[model samples]
Target: MQTALLFPGQGSQYIGMGQDLFTRSIVARRTFEEASEILGYSVSNLCFQGSEADLTRTDYAQPCILTVGIAAFRVLVERMEREPVYLAGHSLGEITALTASGALHFADAVRLVRFRGMLMRDAQKHKAGSMMAVHGLTPQVIEKECLEPEYRGLVVISNLNSSRQTVVSGQVNALTKIKERFTDLGGHVTPLQVDGAFHSPFMKNAAMQLYDELRLIPFHSMRYSVLSNVTALPYPNVNCIPSFLSEQMVERVRWQGCVQFLMERQVYNLIEVGPGSVLSNMLRREKLDACMIQSMDKKEYLQKLIKESLPKGNRAVSYAHYLKAALCAKNYNIHGETSNYLKEVAGPFRELEQLARSGDVADGNAKALEALNHILDCKMTPAIQRGGILSHIAEEGVVRHV
Candidate 1:
């Protein structure tokens, strides 16, 4: 079966969620433990025993959900001997897929996620923005209604979850206005339990922070053809991924595009590797093929999809994957003397940083890193390995090695 792994983002999290798997499977427990070591906090405690309020914090939620997704992914890898033909995720979930596809280390992925949440959270400035799901109609109708002219720039379809279902986000006035439009447009609207508007320009500042994070953090080439939320296709060029990820924050998430692309590519089996059924539900609705949609919330998906997602060679390892333990045998750095684009990345990032000043510290860190990397112009591995002046850049967020 040509399989694809789908990861769910923030809204999928729930209290006392991943405990069952952590308790029952050694693979699951090891993954969680390793994540705790990387993050410098008790991630497992938050996922297993923490209250909703504690786990729901932006910083915590990013890493927490990723750890669970990774934990489940590890178990799947242990059981399955081969990787899938495709991979994707919704919102923050896309980062999870990027990590799984060798574009990032699990530790760095979690850190970036923590910052992703914090920065995005601060960008809001507490205007009481929120999201709601509208179903039972075509995206065309929903868009026309939710995006009526009077509510211009107010209510926008944030998460295009599927062809028939999308989540709208924005101000209260805009949302109420959009809901009326949805009602008139023959679409059903259900207010989501979320607290902020995401995926719209209102979250533009958060997207700016995410752009910064994209710069500072490194991205690697995909082991397989993974869909980009920015373009809804295999990343056009690995070198241009920073912009793609940065824009994904404020740009419309082309989830329907991802599903359609995978389906057209003949991927019959799609796995949702996370803590909920949300992504899977969307896939079933969007793709009518005998689409074997599975989720990490259940044991079956963990066992089945991991087998489907990993390649013949890159399976579970005999060692723990802590950042310190996982460095390359040779110390290599790009030294920033090679490319001009590395320098060009600065302009956009500086713009993002200006927008992020009132936001979280993590937001600043993310943007600054993006600018630094753009100046270096290579994948993170070489961009950060350079010494002297460039070594200064690597220390932005890295936990130093002794």
Candidate 2:
């Protein structure tokens, strides 16, 4: 069955979120290291060891969560053999989805989100605003009440989270008034613990700055369809992604609508591929059987997808190429020079490619498969090898060395 990958945004991060993946997967560690070099601060430190206050800072939080989310995603791809049929991310996660789909390169995504966070933080300096979650009400009711003239001060619906859950953001006074009104109307109102009025006009300045920054980044055509937060629809074209992302800063996250869009497309299996079960919880509330990435039964789930996604029949050469591609992708993600231990396994990787193209189908397949097994089993450092999270081989029920 086809699946859709859901990535969470801010408020989903916590200490040690992706540490397990980083410890277990070479590709995950490389992603963290690459981001650390780009930002000149240890993203791994911020995610794994930083104080809650430090992580909550807009500038720090965006990059930290993005890095962790992407790290988990990379590790997920390495562990599983399936490709997602569609992608959707909440707020900052939209960028993550783009990065995962090849629309934005990893390095470019790290830089862009850092700048985006800075701009949003600066916007808060001049405009003091707040966000509140209004539950037990539909979008129409919340939007109508927000527009009522009595509690006027720039309040607008910020996130359409679900049919019965919507968030509002704007000036504090306006939000307070709306909260009181919603409570009196029997709606549950919980003020969000955010520093700025995100997804509202208060973010106009940040939106403009983000737009300017987006122009400098090259967004390639998406490999998988990504539902846009601003439009609540699949992006018409990749070229439009920049503009949509720019508007996303001040546009309500039409999450409910995005979910509806996915549902209309028959996406029943929605797997959230990042930290926290927030998105999965939200989807479950919508009666969808959504699953999170870091489950205890991850190996079983990973194996099932791998069996489906792996090429079949005469695709032996194609499978060989996939292994090489995975290796090269991991290579680009490495922080410093290749380690001598990894270098020791490079010969087998090279041989796999050679054997695949040698035109002897039977011998080539056997050699390529054997070479892959050797490469995956090659040893590295003791520290890298001994981790709480170990990749598994379903067939042998043994820990994979990769």
Candidate 3:
């Protein structure tokens, strides 16, 4: 099974995200306890009991998410049949991926992200700004809107999450203007739940300080191909990671391109090993086959699914099942009662229904997994073949034609 591991950024955090793994897995408990000592505080408490406001702070959120993300990965790693072929992360999650790939030590990573968050908080304090998610708009239209006379030089596209979802970040006034204009243009605009205007020029000060901190940490050669948010491609060398990671603070997160890169290389099954399903939702919205396993239970389900699907030395074909189901749903709008057969067959991917209904807004974690299971031992239908969505996917990347 060719797999790419994804770690989510700041907004993916929740109060009791890693508590399940910590309670059930000794490896996860050790990872969290080690992180607590490295940061000189109770990271476990911040994740298990902290309120929304506390978890939203840049300093607390970055480390807490990183710790939980890495901890969850540790618990799941022991059961994996193979290591991931690639690793990618969004915003601060990139640091976690780096640590997982052996590019950065866990202790150094926790401390560096903490310091980086503090510096970013300082930058945010000096220059007040905000971010807004503008959906149903192309990147060109959004960029054009940001450069309009009234908002020129103040606002920029901070995150290219998907073809239809772009996030804008800048001064409060500029954000307000863009939000109003985009909404009037028949687009959906929602303010992001963040403490600062991340991935924009507003973070230059933080970027500068973060570079210095990055230099102090020793970086080793990566064990897997790691994609960068700033470049939207794999790093040519391990040496470029530190500077590029620092620069990521003030650059656009080219997430859409990063996912496309993985698909182009045939890395179909992108697994999000963290708390929330944000990245998975974006992948589904783009019609890319993806799944998430955040807790110990989900990890066990994944292992069982893989075992059940690829018994007796069969080459792993679970990813093909997932891709077929996603294509079938997209092309046929196969849902409700018509998809009941799918629900019964999709032992692992039963959650695909919710994902198909909500797109990127779907909050369920098991949908993609269940969809994968449905097609594991099943054959493709004639309708899916005639639609040619899967053929189009092969030639032009993962997004569905319809």
Write down the TM-score of every candidate.
Answer: 0.72, 0.75, 0.73
The ten-residue window of minimal lDDT in model 1 covers 317-326
* 180-229 per-residue lDDT for model 2 (tens digits): 88888889998765678899888887898888889888665565689899
Q: 39-129 in candidate 3: lDDT tens per residue?
A: 8889989898999999989888999888888876654453455657889999888899887776676788889888988987788786788
TM-score top scorer: 2
Model 3 stretches with alpha carbons more than 4 Å out: 289-402
Model 3, 303: alpha-carbon shift in Å? 9.5
Q: Local error of candidate 3 at 24, Å?
A: 0.7
Q: 1 or 3, which is superior by lDDT? A: 3
State each model's CA lDDT, in order: 0.65, 0.70, 0.71
Which sections of candidate 1 miss by over 4 Å? Answer: 38-40, 300-402
Rank candidates, lDDT, best first: 3, 2, 1
Worst 10 residues of 3 by lDDT: 393-402
Quality of model 3 by C-alpha lDDT: 0.71
Cα RMSD to the true fold for all candidates: 12.7, 9.5, 16.9
